[model samples]
Target: MLNYLGDKKDERMKMRNRYRKSTALRCDAGSRCLISVVIGSLMGCILLLNLYSAIRPADEIGQHIHLRTSHHLHFPELEEVEEENIQIPPPRKRSPRATKRRPKKTTTLIDEFLDEDSQIRHKFFPDQKTSIDPMITGNDSMFYYPGRVWLDTEGNPIQAHGGGVLFDERSETYYWYGEYKDGPTYHAHKKGAARVDIIGVGCYSSKDLWTWKNEGIVLTAEETDETHDLHKSNVLERPKVIYNSRTRKYVMWMHIDDVNYTKASVGVAISDYPTGPFDYLYSKRPHGCDSRDMTIFKDDDGTAYLIYSSEDNSELHVGSLSEDYLDVTNVARRILIGQHREAPALFKHQGTYYMVTSGCTGWAPNEALTHAAESIMGPWETMGNPCMGGNKMFRLATFFSQSTFVLPVPSYPNLFIFMADRWNPADLRDSRYLWLPLMVGGLVDEPLDYNFGFPLWSRVSIYWHRKWRLPQGWNSLK
Candidate 1:
């Protein structure tokens, strides 16, 4: 009986051992299967990632095509880049006074442009005899000779420098307003930059933009009132005008400062007519901040805003004006902080607001940068310079001009006249106007972060041209 019981025990032990071996085999097989599944999933995922990477660039191109189709037409002539290969002559000897005033970065071409004794002075600042005389331009009536003297209907050179053009619906005429710097240029102090005394804002009237008629001084200076903001010893620059429909008034805003630019403020003026004897109002710091190099932009919905360089010219301030377009409404926001930019030119295209600004080099020209925003008030994004078509130097120096205003073409979308001041520091009265075709479309080479490095804003291109004209039938088309 004991031997039998012992044999039963051994049999039970053998059965237990067999069960344990089978369970171990099953667990090993399951582990192998899970490993295989994980490897397969990883391989498939890698293949999918590779395919996506390969197709994404083409998809981006397709998206660009889709965008272009939505924006409508493509204008090649407006973007045609006229290459300027100006032979930069060798630097000439300068006197102690010249070297002390002019910095080392002053290129030979800039020297020529600024030199009163330069042999090629006429090349940059052409004499009045070769002016685009509207009286004699019978066949060449509409042609624009850029950088040359532009004459008005009364046989006088147009005095509108740093100008903005306004199309009046009531009178069916375009009124151009700007600084009338027809006075002599001189430095106020030994360290001061070249400037002209306050000569008031000049107004010009035009049916065709090419043929402007002088509308006399719309806003004059305060000659007797020495403490007044518009005093002749003070500074007035970059005068911009907008029509207020509710008030039926023409409102103007300008940068008001002292000779040393210490009293930085914005002056306001208003008139009952487009060709106005605008009443000079007081000057004040918009939003109670120092304002300089300023411009006022009126929106489509009658909301007007002021944009100016503030904080001792270290940044920019933007704020909305009141209902009457005379005062700030406390709806203010600062933008482009730490970017030392001035000479702002603001315009909107297809629901996007754009501004062109230059470096603060006083009268000397510098590179231009374009900032964009969806709203007029806050969070502006810089998208690089808008200048194109010139050589490296010309583009770097903004075609040797500073931005003043961007005049939209009423007849065509995405086409604008980029009005700039080719400041003749030696003679402010001889300052030339640089109006070029500004196009606001096309994909830029530099990719932005949003939309997967796609173009967030349309490229702002200010094409360089030696001579050009408005598109055919531009005025008539409107």
Candidate 2:
């Protein structure tokens, strides 16, 4: 009986010990689960904060800090909405035979805009008397008069039409590149588009945006090679240059096509210097599709991309270039599909991509649309016409101009120079450059198809001005 009692007590003590060990194990597991939940919650909160910072308006987050720090960069003068009033003159009387051949349709302001003999032609293309001469230093010095003749340092009108400006960090100068259309303009066939034979790509250098020094024909046309792509009979236009840091070379890309414009392709050229006699490498149809009206953009991360009108100008394709910045990769995403956008001038701000595009209206100025995307290759949403301050007709016609490039102002957040071409189809070489202030801020005016009533992008405004200049000391911070 004594042995049995002892054994029973020992067994009871062992059972108590076992129960305590199991309870301790359960408590440890519960503590571990609580720690995991806390860590996971922290990570999720961080992700949500980052996402909010990206999509929020510039003024909401740190734009106030920028405003306080860079008060000198504030451009209240540029932000002021300047209205324009253009009176379309009465139509010229047409002859009976001319009227009979073409039935009398209701004439529009666009008709007057295209007519060389339009009474308001001077309004669109002012004569040399009111040219923007950089040499003449007075109250009007450094001011930009849009639609007026812009003379280079040599007292000759700048001939870089459909051009883009590159700010070279090494030399700290801006280089402008475009089609050298100093040659005569004519139609190749009865129905061919009016074009100036490939006189070559022109290069001009400038310390300030004003006062350009001609760099001559950087890439000349082939005079004798009838089958060559750069032959005088072919088309070469919208040449853009971007520097490759890895290769330390300047790459030039332009639209190459036949006079008939059926052979649409892009040509590439490279040079060691900004003012270049570039070697024409070759031309190709990127992704085996017809390309025209293209532009190349070098991102802040040193990656370059090519955006071109493809599939008969019904859509645009965005693709990354090779590491050397010479060729496109197999990766291509078609954005703005079926929107019929061309003249793509892309710029990024506050981690968002913005583009200004024109309609496929040939030389005639059409409505300009601004698009925004969270990613470069993305589902870009159209944000309506960016033209502001101008009258109804002026806004409708993109201020009588087509977008060529959107140049960011150094050290000035959300400020850019909107460069465009006031095309003169009758006299192609006499085209004028329209530089206006483009600001990215405020809520988007149009509702997005997605987003469920929430604003997803900022408004891109290209404010029109008859005469405007960069803020007094815009380049001082540079």
Candidate 3:
């Protein structure tokens, strides 16, 4: 009876050992299964992320496409616009000399600025009253007195007219460059339009967007040399700059033509420095085609492209610049053909390309059109004028100005500074700069083929304000 009891006990112990081994194996299998599932999930998520980035448009297009310039600009790229940085200074105190004497009948500054015959005309022009004094404190502190003669740090009127701004990141400063129209303005031919002798490109730098220091004429026209491409009598308007990382040089492109604008070609210039005496290389009909009213855009990935109104102002051509950022590559595509558009200011929001253009009218305000494209090349869709808030006349007239440039305020989303020129054809020197608030919002007024039934982009509206500054926080981020 004792032996039989002992055998039964041994059998029970073996059974218990077997059960323990089985439980341990099961736990190991479960852990392996869980690890496999976790790894698979992680890999799947990474794949989806890559695919999403590939499809996202905004990821591809950067802040407003950067215009051409001659500097290693390292300004941080902005994705949205905020209110402008406008700090109004305190009122000015009368100088002791002026306080000691009876104030000559206080003619209003605006009246004196507008009156061509006023004795203070010189004050508003080349004289001291309206002269842009960088050293002046008080009301003039960091104020852009529009229509007032803006003097450089050298106390000379900055010659950058119809110009564009290039934010240089490397130096943490902004460079203002444009046509230096210093020469006298006159009619080119018996029936030709009024024009000034080409004076090349003017460069100015500003830390605070208001106070500008002149860098001098970076590209000066050939004064007495008629054979030169930049001959003083020739046409050189709307000079734009871009940096070419490949070539390691600043490339400039401008609208080069004769007195009658018969030489319908784009001129190219190069400089090693931002403030430069650029070397005029040559002019060309880009892609073996006529180009006018042209501008260049540099992408975030270092790829640059050019857009020009071509085929007798009936269409536009867009082509990518070579890797070196100088000449146009063989790749060329025609967009907005037969659209009869000019004065294009292109910007990109959320990977979508947006452009503002005016009709082919000469020196007269006409209806403006805003266009968009998924790609920079072809099939651009027209989405009517983006002008809003103003009366019908203001919307149709682009606030009585022509599109020059759309400056983006860093801190504001969908808000931009619409810069235009209210050209005084009778007196070009008296031309006024019209800057309005441009906001992109609401369903587009028109339908697009790509958008199916609903509009793909928000409507673009330029609000007309008699006097306005960028909304609060526009430049606060900077």
Candidate 4:
């Protein structure tokens, strides 16, 4: 009886141990178990991802290889990574007496960029005669020269700056709208920022994103009415458009300010068609707050929102527009406060919201920041600089360009086009567009987060290239 009882007790002990082991794995593993599991899962995922990525084309390398394999469409040469090793020439000698009277100061490349009569002026503002005219350029049809002057089908230089593109599904075309700064550039006062009179917003239509056809000045500035919000003496910049399916209206939202930038407001205009002489309606401080350097985003749903720099551009605010896409609703949420970020370009991917913003420096290139949020409204996290593959200085200065827009490549999950302006402050009309490839993937280079051991965000990379073109079969990239 004693032996049987001992056997039963031994069996019960084994059962108890098994139950305890399953319930509290930490007891045997010392809490390192969870981390081990995580790491193991991560490594397994990495292996699988690497295997799949090795087989996939167009994504592994920056070039679009998948399109070439299937469709056999001939695209311009995929721009190779070219680096610039420009050196600053020595300063000119001045007479000692003249130097004593007026000190000979050191000048930087930035100073050269801001000086209209600098000896290197041609380097920045190349002659428009050698422009990218798609009509006559046979083999170079889709080639994009980063700083070269770009012309439309009408043989006129494209005037769309600080622009946003809208893919019109109904018409099966893309409509791009932006500030039409075709007139001369000037400053309102000695200390004022570089200004271009409100000549109005220009629109361009394209079957492909390349080779635009000018739609003329869709929204004209008020030439006579001085009190008008769009008066020639005032400011109208960064115009973005979105179509409302519910209202069937193409609504425009732009930064409308006075010459001194004291009246910081957003103007609303609407038309029934994409190409239009839009009817200017009114301007207002959205949510009873100052708005500037703004952009409009349409969500996967019909809901659209306007995001702008507020609190004197120290922070940004996002609020949904009314169903008609005319004005802001009462609900407004502040984001990236005290970050001193401006020129927000927002886009969404796989239900996560992402934004690219520049510093508050006027007409100067600064480091670009990419932010991600689970929700569109709040608690956003900075994902560090999205620039990669350039020299350290090039990455830091955003390739000498400021964020204007982040365009998504349809059907291509992580591929995007980073559109920016290489502003020529001396003559804003000579500003050039910088279109670079932006991709989001891989472990970020920066330390992920202080609160956690690894980064929660993916690295956003903008590859630097002298000339690049979209893969011929971008839409069908599987």
Candidate 5:
């Protein structure tokens, strides 16, 4: 009996050992399977995230949510396409003496535009009877009638031409700086371009951009110094001002040239106040290159850049400014090479940089091309003309205007005021301001040269309007 009990216990012990081994193996297999599943899921999620990032638009990837929303908003009123069909009248009979002085050639709409005696001159330059007098309290109080005479608070025509707006945060006012070309216009020589003697840079202050209060000639011409850069015989155009926080100074940059336009250089000036008696510092060719048709852009980080037409206006050169905002740095890059462009007006949206430039067609208006880059110092890609809502000829001629500065409307993301000069070569002081709506949103109309199967940036559209105003409650947002 004892022997039989011992055998049974031994067999039961053996069976229990085998059962424990099997249970241990099963638990090991289950743990391994769970770990594999977790690892696979994690890998799959990472792969999807990489794919999404790769497909997303570069400009949109790191953009702010509010900016994205603002850009996508449908501003139908501002974007409304208004067509203008201007009919060129038949040529008037000229006297034999007049015909002998000037031979008649193929006359296009542009030809009529340059002619001071054009039969449709009234169409381009409306008489003073239709002037935008801000002092007048009526239905036209704040409405902007583009192409009409814009009078200051004193009832004189605003002399800010080829100008730029500087928002002074401390005073919360907009200071407009430009060539104060209020003098008589004439050609320096028989073969020279139409010009007005330097009267120094004009500054105008405004709470609302429509109603300007003249700040007088902030930077006065050097009357006695014939060799001065600001001498009456010299040329000073496109004066842009930006405030430097570090230096606590308002710095101005302008295109300074001789009467023959042979000395293409940039002049620098500094002011203690926004409405300034700016002190003229000096002038130099930036990067040792002949610079003209220049503009200064102050970036969000307080860094500033100078962009100018170089290589005899065959290309554009961009360089950073010294910390003092007084001079250009050694870092420079040539952009839009061999593509003769001038009248550069640059603005940033989201993470992309955009520039509106005109062909090097002297004072006459030409097609405006918009270029974009991921960087400011760029390998810029031309995005074709941004003009919209005009007739074919109007669009082709940039609405008979040249870009000077692009002002971003406060509190309105992606919405900017396209400030251009409808230059009257015959009378530079009579130049009209074309402040139209410029928006950045839709895909580019023209395929880029190196987009690699996807569009790189948003389309820049400057909508044309015979007359347009900012949306209601624009100032309230500020």
Candidate 6:
């Protein structure tokens, strides 16, 4: 009887341990759900608060706050007569040769953006007077003029085009690293498309996220070495950096190919500093699969992963990096197979992974799709275009741009910064950057692969704005 009792007690102990483990997992799941709710709620509150403030009467807000009285105004009071508001310049007439070739349709934001002579071009690429000058104050503070030539602290247009942002905790500064294309844009071969001499990766540093300081070329292209992968005649685009703690190195992975883009491999570089004269290690097809338009993501736990469009841009492959982040581990899984997607930018929120990708259109705007997965791997769901607002044309054109990065705002949970490249095939170097507010909330409009009838994640939306700024005090919160 004692032996039988002991056996029963052992069984009970095992059951208790199992029960405890199950409870812990349940609690974790519950915490994740709570986090999602809290994030969604906070975003909703911010949106409502902003809307209220926008609609609230200016007098009402003034009534609540105390104002200092002075006989001689220290700051100039509103001038009674603002001579008739500055008149908008008239639109320029299109060349007869151009009009004769093709009739102009109703002008679009894209048309204005593309037309070098459009009256609205000034609005998109503002004059030096309105550039992101560090000396500028008021409404211009922390404002990003997407597509406009952004100048560094030295009063020169920043060269980091097609870039990515990396926030370095070690330096407490955000580094914007990208291609420094300062060469003439021209076609390579007789039939080849527009190309430019590989200029190298540029780096810029910023504390307030507005005024940037040029850090010079971190990785310069080989000029004389024709066999070199980074030879100036070759192609290099979309350079992204992520710090690896285990290796204690800043690693950069970029698209490296020839003039015709036949060498479809990712080139890896390593540097001890963020401003890198990175040592070019090697280039290879990740998992022996062709990679193009890729980005690396570092998880919260210090595990860096690579996501690249592979199989001739038919699908995307994702895999965790080796502990050192130098090589892709043997284990890799193909996600979004046969999807024909490229220009991938990924972000995670509320324990759910989201990716924004553009269709494989060469240098033209196309509809963007947002994909979601419970895990970062298989069984992804394709929701419709995430763009909202603006006229139908703007939404369809993705605000006239292509996906490059989805930057999470530290202060606002659901709010994210959507960065895209507005390529000008005519002048590759003249391509512009598009940064807009992206929010992940509201009901998922479509079905998931496995969750047939259930809505598993919130709908991702990138709102189009002629001009917009982050919510006030957002930086302070961060």
Please give, for residues 422-474, the per-residue lDDT of candidate 6 as tens digits.
77666666666778778776555666543324354677878666556666566
Error of 6 at 132 (Å): 3.1
| Tens digit per residue, CA lDDT, model 2, 284-366 | 99877789999999988998999999878988989899988889887777777668999999999878899999999999999
The sequence of per-residue lDDT tens digits that candidate 4 reaches over residues 371-434 is: 8887898667787898765567667778778888888877667677888888888777778888
Q: Which pairs clash in model 6?
A: none
lDDT of each: 0.82, 0.86, 0.68, 0.80, 0.87, 0.75
Query: Which window of ten consecutive residues has the lowest lDDT sum in model 5?
Result: 18-27
Worst 10-residue stretch by lDDT in candidate 2?
18-27
Scored by lDDT, the top model is 5
Clash counts for all predictions: 0, 0, 22, 1, 0, 0
- Candidate 1 achieves a global lDDT of 0.82
Residue-level lDDT tens digits of model 5 in 1-478: 2221245457446544633433233347659888778869997997787688669887776464335445565589889979887888876789999999998776888988899999888888999999999999987787877788999999999988998999998998999998888899999899999999999888899988888999899999989899999899999999999999998999999999999999999999998899989999999998778998999999989999999998789888899999999998888777776689999999998888999999988878889999999899886888899999889988999989999999998878779999999999999989998889999886666867544333556789999887778877887227
Residue 45 deviation, candidate 3, in Å? Answer: 36
lDDT per residue for candidate 3 within 1-478, as digits (tens), equals 2221245457446544643433233347659888778869997997787577447776242331222111112212221322222222333578879867956445443333344565544432344465557777775465444445566777776667666777766676777788776656688668988777787788998876567888988998888889777898888877788777667688888888888777888988999877877898999888777787878877767788888888788878788988876688877766665579988888776567789999987766778999988788756888888776445655676755688777766655566777676554545654555556676654566766333343455567676554344443445336
Q: Which pairs in model 5 have colliding backbones? A: none
Candidate 4 Cα deviation (angstroms), residue 329: 1.3
- Native RMSD of candidate 1 (Å): 17.8
Clashes of 1: 0
